[model samples]
Target: MRFPRSSGLLLHPTALPSPWGVGDLGPSAYQFVDFLAAAGQSLWQILPLGPTGYGDSPYQCFSAFAGNPGLISLDHLIQRGLLSYDEVVEASRRYDLNADQVHYGEVLAFKLPLLRHCYERLREGGAPDMAVAFTQFCRDQRAWLDDYALFMTLKEAHDGRSWHDWEAELRTRDPKALAEARTQYAEAFTLQQFFQFLFFQQWLPLKAYANEHQIRIIGDAPIFVAYDSADVWANPELFFLDAEGKPTVVAGVPPDYFSATGQLWGNPLYNWQRMAEDGYAWWIKRLRAAFTQMDILRLDHFRGFAAYWEVPAGEETAINGRWVKGPGAALFKRLEEEFGALPIIAEDLGLITPDVIALRDQFDLPGMKVLQFAFGGGSSNVYLPHHHVPNCVIYSGTHDNNTTVGWFEDLTEEEREVIRGYLGRSGSDIAWDFLRLAMMSVADMAVVPLQDVLRLDARARINTPGRLGGNWGWRFRDDVLNAGLAHGLHFFTEMYGRLPPQPEPDEPAEDATTEDELIYDPVDLATTA
Candidate 1:
């Protein structure tokens, strides 16, 4: 579907500051929504909401369908009488130290125990209406929730070991063993479900509030699933893995700007041939889950859908990888058939090939253009605003790149001079310079990372692709969203005609054909994997 001209902030919920350890779908999230409205933003983009597993990366989640329990608000639990204010207050004190960045370990240590307590309280019949709602939600989401709950319970039972390290019966998902496990870990299973219920329960209202405020949510969905994820464990046949459940081949990009040997993402490669035979059912369900949570979906690694780099499982670097054809238009065609018009943005960054561009254009999905990648060399860079197409979404920087301020600090004189000549601006406030440039670009959408908005340096960097540890932990302070900053954003938004209209009183409208009902195009039709 074609998007209207608009702009927004790319701040993950985890980055939203709260008195609690990590951000949640609590008051802070709602306030963030209000802040977006005040700042004249029509969109609010976030990283995946799935529960992080290894390295606490949102991209490598336990289950694509599950919500991150860590994001549940203890404050809300207190209000519901599931937890005591005093208890949460004490837990808060313990984890309240990280004012600038998320202390994931500390946050998890404090939240998990209290979350388990909340789960126990709910099981004891906390609130009748809420209990009924949770039950129905569990029933509705049973398809993926059943396996995810069992998976989490098992993960806890195995002291957080990968499912492959579990006993053979559970590892191979023997029916008899699973039946016994359900009976044995019945409480654990229920507790996990309770967490999901809490997440969805809280999240739905926040999303509704955004929608009511005339704001649309943009959510991220990684192209590859983590090897140690519940998805891979539950559906082993869908991936390129050995009988022992280790990946025979892995996912990565060959030598690129990010790394000399390229990024060894270490995700298990999908057996696309097998997936295509089944009409990409697993992917459809995954995207279905995503659409339920957000209005628009950004397909991370969009090029991977056309063709992906397959690295040997045992390789330390991605240099030994070979390019393998991906499902491409065939998968998207299936998605369109099942879900109707797709509101998707393609993360068509890196060494994009013609096939990838063709697939994206076929669906008319908006591709990305990052200003950070525009001035490293010359004006020929496609990421430069002059070269960007009107159908694309422009960004000052993305999660993988350093904050624009940090990026400016690291640039050489020649590169800095090139950027200055192009934008015709001084580098004193580099972040805002790029932000203004992106906002004024002809691209239909512009999304600046929250770090750039706050003018934070390396300290607020979200992720550095090849590096390990100390990523995805940055959080804005409570006082960061001051009136001055909001005014600046508002002025630019109005200047560019990107400000969203304020919510008005409800009114009945005339019948109209929605975009989904339009004539379906066969350009995104079935093709070989």
Candidate 2:
């Protein structure tokens, strides 16, 4: 989809500062929104907000349609009278909330119990209005919520084993066993729904606040669902599963410059023929749910939507995979019919084919460009700002890439010289230099990672693909954001015409001096006014 000429910062909510051992949809989130407004940012991009499983990767979530309970705010519950401030304070004492990195294991241990306590309070007839709202939320979201709540309750019963490892009756979803299990785990199931209710209860208001400040949110959605997810378990027939309910083929990428053996992502491949029988109903619902939380959705691995790499289930690496045709235009046609003019940004970064470019252009969706990739080759590199199209979204770096400074530090001296010569600078401030290149480019939108904005190095990188652990743990300190930082960023934003046009100034009184007039130079006044 075409976007406004604007810029934003890419920082997952997990990176926000809080005293709860993890960033959440609490006061700090609102403060971050305020920062975005002050910085003249028009977008707030985030990773997927789904509940993470074994690896704590947002992309591999428990449910495509559920919120991550780990992001719910207990302090918000205190305001609602479902939790007390003293209790929250006491709970905060058990974990290192001020740590620079997230301890996922400790966060889960600390959050789940308190979430359950809030659920119990609601069950005990506290907060009648919220109880009513919760009931309405469940009813409104029943199509997906019922299955997700049941799936989570069952996972807990089985000690966190994948559904494929469950008994035959439950694994295959035998009706009699399913009926009995629901009755026995009714409270647990309801509690899962309540957690979702609280997540959206806090999230929607935060999203609205960002919107009110003219800052649109861009949320991520993976092209493939995890094999162990509720979507796969609840609707096994939609995937290429064998008789025993295991995937026959999986998703991954073929060998490329990055890896000789290629990357094998063990996600279940979709049975496109089966899905088409119902007019791609599943994808429609998934996108519809995603739109409820975000203004624009970034489709991860956009090339996979045109043709995906399919490897037989037991393959050790992606070298043995073959390209298989996806649903392509038919799937997107159905989505557009449901929600017109798809507000999507395609993650068309790696190994893109003509067909993928065709698919993206057919929908007029914006693809991405990362400045970190530009200096690797000559002028023909599509990532270079000179070759950039006005329909793309530009970035200084992405979640998968190191901070711009770190990337520059690791480059060969010759490569560094090439970049410096191209930009006509000595590369003293690489992060802001990259940011300036991105903002001054013709791309419709530009987003810089918060780590790059903070001038952090590799130590603050958000994620590094293929690594098993220690990814998705970085968080920024609370003291880093200040008025000077906002003003500095706004200078670039305003100078590049990314900020929205300001209204004309009214006539000033004889002794009046407003904040804008007091702070800005006469040149700034002429430009802004």
Name the runs in model 2 displaced over 4 angstroms. Answer: 501-529
Instruction: Give the number of the best model, judged by lDDT.
Output: 2
Instruction: Please write out the lDDT profile of model 2 over residues 107-146, one tens digit for every residue.
Output: 9888888889988888889887678777867777788888
**Candidate 1 TM-score over all chains jointly:** 0.94
The stretch of ten residues in a row with the least summed lDDT in candidate 2 is 520-529
TM-score per candidate, chains pooled: 0.94, 0.94
**Superposed Cα deviation of residue 88, candidate 1 (Å):** 0.9
- Which residue runs of candidate 1 sit more than 4 Å off their true CA positions? 94-97, 501-529
* Tens-place lDDT digits, model 1, residues 37-152: 88999999999999997689999999888899989877777877889989887776766547667888888888888988887777788876667766766676777888999999
Global lDDT for candidate 2?
Answer: 0.88
RMSD of 2: 7.5
